[model samples]
Target: MPYDVEKPDEQWRAELSPSEYAVLRQAATEPAFTGEYTDTRTEGVYSCRACGAELFTSGTKFESHCGWPSFYDPKDTDAVELVEDRSHGMVRTEVRCARCGSHLGHVFEGEGYPTPTDQRYCINSISLRLQPTDG
Candidate 1:
């Protein structure tokens, strides 16, 4: 369970804002439709807000109407780590930044989404830092 960018809780809290710490460190979900990246369509790469690790690209983003930003895939397979989550009366897959082990969000699959992966990486905007591509 050790991460490449391991830091003490105090350090993490010092670096992240209150909202970012809740979602990224404590795995709390932000209110639906409130995330900054929910409706963003600009070309960019989304990196981990806590660790600066590239996680997803705009090309893989889709409108899932699920209130959060949805990506069909990670920037790379190794960019994220998926773990089985059995909380809140449901079984789901939790996605985290591979480098820092900060929670990104849950990933759901096989719900008939019209995407190559048919999967939705439902991530919180507070968990990401978007770096827009230069045109």
Candidate 2:
């Protein structure tokens, strides 16, 4: 099927590669330490992989050791949406694109961090693109 940016299902497949689409749109998780942003220490903002919407920043990211990119808070409250995820026989808060409502990942609480926000935004690399700021 031809991918279309205007079409949710089609654009998702077209805009993202198979692996990116699977993890970003379908909420499928990549193997531990397999994500590109997992160990990223760059100084910049992280935008959506599917869309160029700013979500998190490098300052908000912390070493959660969860094999995924973890952030203490998001750059914007409306940049991402949250949904009730009931997959894998457990309830989780699913994160999505506020603009397109694309699945991003899950956020967890009590991650034991000392950021402005104590919450951990366990995001997927396929769901984000780090944009380094001016040096």
Candidate 3:
């Protein structure tokens, strides 16, 4: 799919670090429980690390104890794109930044989390840039 912030592979590689490119461009998953945002509770907006597009907010973040950071919803309905993922012998919803089409992570549902959407957006920390709000 075409993205609003389309760039050549060479440019993306030059812009993002090795690990960031691996997750954002190559759809690689970071090791669970090792992400920076896994236990972060700061109030802020989490933007896509690759394109600076706001994808989530601290208000929607919740502790699902799922290792990675979890959000009940995106900042806006169109802020992300969910695609059916059938890799690694399983089916799941893969989340990507709508603006840049960079991989954020996967979203899960029906696990009985007491959230308004009943969905868990398990995102990678390296895929996000948290902008903490001033008190």
- My TM-score estimates for the predictions, one after another, are 0.98, 0.90, 0.98
By lDDT: ranked, best first: 3, 1, 2
Q: Which regions in candidate 2 have their CA more than 4 angstroms from the true location?
A: 1-6
Write out the backbone clash pairs for model 1.
none
What does each candidate score in C-alpha RMSD?
0.6, 3.6, 0.6
Error of 1 at 102 (Å): 0.3
Cα-based lDDT for every prediction = 0.97, 0.82, 0.98
- TM-score of model 1 vs. true structure: 0.98
Q: Predict model 1's lDDT versus the native.
A: 0.97
Could you give candidate 1's per-residue lDDT for residues 27-118 as a string of tens digits? 99999999999999999999999999999999999999999999999999999999999999999999999999999999999999999998
CA RMSD (A), model 2 = 3.6
Candidate 1 minimal-lDDT segment of 10 residues = 1-10
Per residue, candidate 3 scores C-alpha lDDT tens digits across 1-135 of: 889999999999999999999999999999999999999999999999999999999999999998999999999999999999999999999999999999999999999999999999999999999999998
lDDT of 2 at 125: 85
Give the lDDT of residue 73 in candidate 3.
99
Error of 1 at 135 (Å): 1.4
